[model samples]
Structure formats: structure tokens, C-alpha cells
Target: MLGGLHFWFEIRIFMHFIKKRRNKPLYKKFLPLRKNVQNRNKLLWFRKKKWQKFQRAFSRLKKKKLHDPKSYFLSTFKNFFSRKFKYNLQNKQRLSLFYGGFRKKYLKRVVKSTLKEFKSLNKHVTVLFIEKLETRLDTALYRTHFSYSFKNARQLISHKKVYVNNKVVQHNSYLLKKGDVITLDKDVFNFVILNILDSEMWPIPPKHFYVNYKTLQILVIEDIHYTNCLMYYPFWIDFNSFLKFYER
Candidate 1:
């Protein structure tokens, strides 16, 4: 009877083990289905949020009177013209500042002549013109080790202490052309050489220009190209828009 009881107990335990194993498949199948449902719901929620964001942006744009084609075009044109006018005014002010201390009429004449020259050169006023202005005798002196600053270079020129092609130039705006040779007076040369040795003011020369440190002279070997000028002084003025606004 004890053996029969033991056998019955073993059978009961075996049946329990089989019953648990059969339930495992059901748990596995239902658990994965539940997780898949959760993932699908999460994806839907994310898509709904993205759609809401897009809707808000669209509503804002519509409220700004941008939904109508004619209104959109008019608003765009107004903004463009306003910005262009403001830039042109700033350019005029810069030109006036460049000729500072000169008579207003003379400044206006210079601006007009410069604009006319730009119009005659290319359909767009290229950066080469700006480079020409920047590489003038006084400007070059300031850029090289000859002068402490551009103002100092201008003062030196005005005092007849600077020469180009072996002739003294009093005007600071005298643009240096290709193949021009620049030299300094003996006194100014000695003074600047001493300063250069004392200070760490040595800057690389411009690509088209070369400076002889030994002889204290500069030579413009080539003309300033548009590509090179753009690399140096980049301006935000759009050439096509500038031409259209000026009716050039």
C-alpha cells in the first residue's frame, strides 16, 4: 500500500509538470501579441504628435496671410525691397565714410564716378574694384610691415614720405596698378625697418604683390583678380539685385 501510494504521488507530480509545460505556449503567444499591440500604439502616438506639430505650423503660416498666392507674392516682394533699400543705403554711407573729411559734393562725385565705372566694367561691379582700392600705395604700406596702421600709412603719404614708380605721391587714394614699384624715403624706411625688427608685425604679403624686406620696396606683379578679391573682402551685395535696383 505504501508503494502504491508512492507511485500515485509520482504520477501526480508528472501530470503537474506536463500541465505547466502545456501552458507555456499559451503564455508565450499571448505575451508577444500584447507587446506587438503596445508597440503599434506607441507608433500611432508618435505619428499623431508629428501630425499635430505640422498642423500647428501650417495654421501659423496660414494666419500670416501667406496662404493666398497674391498676398504671399506681395509680402515677399515688400520684404525683399525693404532689405535691398536698407543695404543700398548702408553702402552709400560706407562710401561717404571712405571719403570722410572731404566736401559732401566731392564725395558724391566720387561715389557717382565709382558707380559709373562699375557699370562700365561688368554688368556686375566685381570685387576687383574693391581690391584696387585696398591695394593702393597707402593701403599696401599699412598691410605690409612699413606702417603701424592704415592711418599712419595715409599720414606718411600725405607728408611725401612714400613713392611709387620713383615719384612721390601725396594722395593716399592713388591706386597702385600692376608692375608699379613702391619705395619709401630713407628716413621712413630706416624707422619702419627698426619697428619691424622690434615688433612681431610681419604679415604675409598679398598674392599679387611682393615685398622685398631687404630693399624695403614693394612690387605689384599682377592685377587683382575677382576670385582673389572675393577671398579677401566678401560683401553681401547681390550683383543681380544690385543691378536691378540701380537700373544699370
Candidate 2:
């Protein structure tokens, strides 16, 4: 009788284990629901945090003289327009000066037309323009120290010593794209290796261009970062002014 009872207990335990295993699929179905609820809660938490930050900023603004809603709104509007106008004037002057002599009447029209075209082509005109300027074959060669100066870079290109994507390109103004490979002619490559490599006058390549000193090759990795580009040519253009001008 004891053996039979033992056998019956074993059967009961086996059945319990089977039932628990059967319930696992049902439990797994609810697991996704739990995870989704958790994700929603996290999103709500982030939104709440952002709203609180905005409220704090608004309160700080209120602590300033902008206590009344009408006054606050008016002051904000005035500040915005003032900043915008300043930016527009700066870019108009800079670009006008760059293209040619700065004539207020002529430059105004040029700025207006350029802004329209930029708006159609890209959302960030300043970035696009800087990218165009920095990625030219001559500019890249100069930055890579393959040429002593931008003028030298242009000369090298004009001599048919620069190859882009394995095709000889004599144009110094050829724009480079990401992953475009630039190779120098054998004579130029040898000259750079002997005369320019490790020389005191060798320039450090900008962050956007990758140089292979061993192979005398340059790869355009990406467009230069706006901040870094500014550091390199601060006087060339003012980005804030450009934005303001373009928006207007």
C-alpha cells in the first residue's frame, strides 16, 4: 500500500510539472503586453520631464521684466526680429563681398536669389555651401598637404596631376563626395613623398578629409562639421547671419 501511494504521488508531481510547462506559452503572450506598457510609461515620463524643463525656463523669463503676457510676447517678437535682421545684414555683406565688390542694391538682389535657390536645394544653406567649398579637389589637396597652398593645389590639378575616382580631372573646382578616392600622378606622388612628407610645412588634414600618407591618397569622409569649418575660415562667412539672411 505504501509503494502504491508513492507511485500515486510521483504521478501527481509529473502532472503538475506538465501543467506548469503548458502555462509558459500563455505567460509569454502577456510578456509583450507588459513590455509595451513599460515603453509607454517611459515615453510619458520623458515628455513630462521636457514639459517641466520648459515650465522652469518660462518661469525664469517671467522673473525678468516680462511678467505680463502681452509684454512678454511683444518683447520676444522684437528680440527675434532684431536678431534676424542683424544676421541677414551680416550674411548679405559677407557673401556680396566674397562674390565681388559689395554693392548694397546688387547684393540684395543676389542674396535674395541665392537664398531662394538654396531653400529649394537644401534646408541648411550654410552647411551646404561650406561643404561645397571645403570638398573641392584643390581644397582637399591643400588640406592634405599634398600641395603647399590652395594656389599650388589648383596648379597641380591644372597640370593634370590629380585623379578623381581613377579618372584624370584637370578642374580644381571638382567637388568631392563621400568615399571619393583622390590619387596623385606618379611624379607628383613621388615628389610629395620625398619633399612634403614629414616636412615642417606639411599641413594637418582637416577632420573631413582622410589622408593616406603611405599611398599619397585622400578620401573624402564626409562634410566638415560647421563649427570646425568656422574655426578654419572664420572670416569667410558668418553662419548665423547666413541663416537669418536666407530666412528673410
Candidate 3:
């Protein structure tokens, strides 16, 4: 009787596990279609978790001191594994299609247009790549420890908490240009410098405007972001020309 009761109890626990998992719609419905959608979902989830852990590890390292080589080595290994994991997870074609259709729509459009324009103007323009502009905004807010995550930055801006050149800017992803003074809600100004030291984290904004602080010059005041700004650069008049013009 005890053996029979034990078997019954095991069966009941198994059923409870099934019931709990069935509450999640994806797992419930995705049992049979193991070919395309299920695999794609798995890849997406793996990439997301990997990226989150990578970000957390990087954040912790940035805050702590690295005196010993052993701790540094482990942290470096974690970073490498995180990047490799992301690369593996990102290699799926179906997942790419899903992301391209919805979440990465704007990014794809921007890249396609930029590449097309580059090819048209200079047929020699071989290397074309797309990077998220939001990454810069995120660095300004989080990695630099200026504020926090992108979500917090957006919240701060929408509440009229950020300013540019003495005017309130509610837009979070405001593409910064040279000579554009970025202030904080009319309170204090943080000098936005170009050619920043940390090139990996804070990439220099796509060069449209040129600034020479010594000469006190500003060139190509194109307030617009992300279009043909970086594509067309006339060889005759270099970035120095802008400085000379401003100097006079």
C-alpha cells in the first residue's frame, strides 16, 4: 500500500508541474512545432539572458578595483564567454528575420538608406555597417553613470528634465553634434566634447559638423540626425576649412 501511495504521489507532482508550465502560453502551444518557431524563441531567450548577464558583469567590473591578475583574468573570461554566447545565439536566420521585421525595423531602414547613399556617391565605399545610436544615449545615461538605464533616461527627459543649449529637450535619443551645448534642465551644463577618450564605449558621433575650439569655429550646422550627413564629405574643403571660416 505504501509503495502504491508513493507512485500515486509522484504522478500527482508530475501533473502539477505540467499544469504550472501550461499556464505559460508559449510553452503550452509550442510543444509540437519544434522546427522553426520553438528553436527561434529559444535562441532569442538565450541571447537576452546572455546579454543581461554580460551587462551586469561589466557594470560590476566598472565599479570595482582590479588589483590582482586572477580576478581580472576571470572577469576577462566572463566577458569573452558572454560575447561568444551572444554571437552564437545571434547566428539564427529565423530569429534575424523576426527581429528585422519588428524590433529592428528602424535600425534596418537607417542602415539600408545609409549604405545605398554611400554607394551612390562613392562607388568605392566598400565597408558599410549599422550600429545602434541608442547605444550612445545609453552610455551617456548608464555606463558613464550619469543617470541609469535607457528607460530612466527617457523618463527623466519626458518630464522636462534634460536641456540642450538652454532649451528643454524631451527626446531621449537626441543625436549630439559638435558645438551643441547639452545642459541639464536649465540648471547646469555638461560640456559635450568631441573625440572623447573612450572610443569603444562612447563612439564619436558620425562626423557632420567640425569644431576647432582653439580657432572658435563651427562648420555644417546640420541639426538633422542619421541621414546623408556622414556620406558626403568634400575633399577640397577639409574639417579645417570650417575652423578657418569660423576664425575669420
Q: Top TM-score: which candidate number?
A: 1
Q: Is candidate 1 or candidate 3 better by lDDT?
A: 1
- Where is model 3 poorest over a 10-residue stretch in terms of lDDT? 233-242
How far out, in Å, is residue 198 in model 2?
7.2
What's model 3's TM-score? 0.34
Screening candidate 2 with a backbone cut-off below 3 angstroms (N, C-alpha, C), the clashing residue pairs are: none
Global lDDT scores for all candidate models: 0.56, 0.57, 0.37
State how far residue 55 of model 1 sits from its true place (Å). 44
Candidate 2 local lDDT, residue 91: 46
How do the predictions measure up, each by TM-score? 0.51, 0.49, 0.34
lDDT per residue for candidate 1 within 70-147, as digits (tens), equals: 221111225776866665644443333322223455534544556777766762354533554666677788667587
Candidate 1 residues lying further than 4 Å off, grouped into runs, are 1-86, 89-111, 114-124, 194-203, 234-248
The superposed Cα distance between candidate 1 and the true structure at residue 164, in angstroms, equals 1.4
How do the residues 69-99 of candidate 2 rate in per-residue lDDT, one tens digit apiece?
A: 1221111225777866544554454444332
Candidate 1 vs. true structure, TM-score = 0.51
Residue 209 CA displacement from its true place in model 1, Å:
1.0
| Residue 143 in model 1: lDDT | 62
Q: Write the per-residue lDDT of candidate 3 for residues 70-89, one digit (tens) a residue.
A: 22121122577685443333
Clashes of each: 0, 0, 0
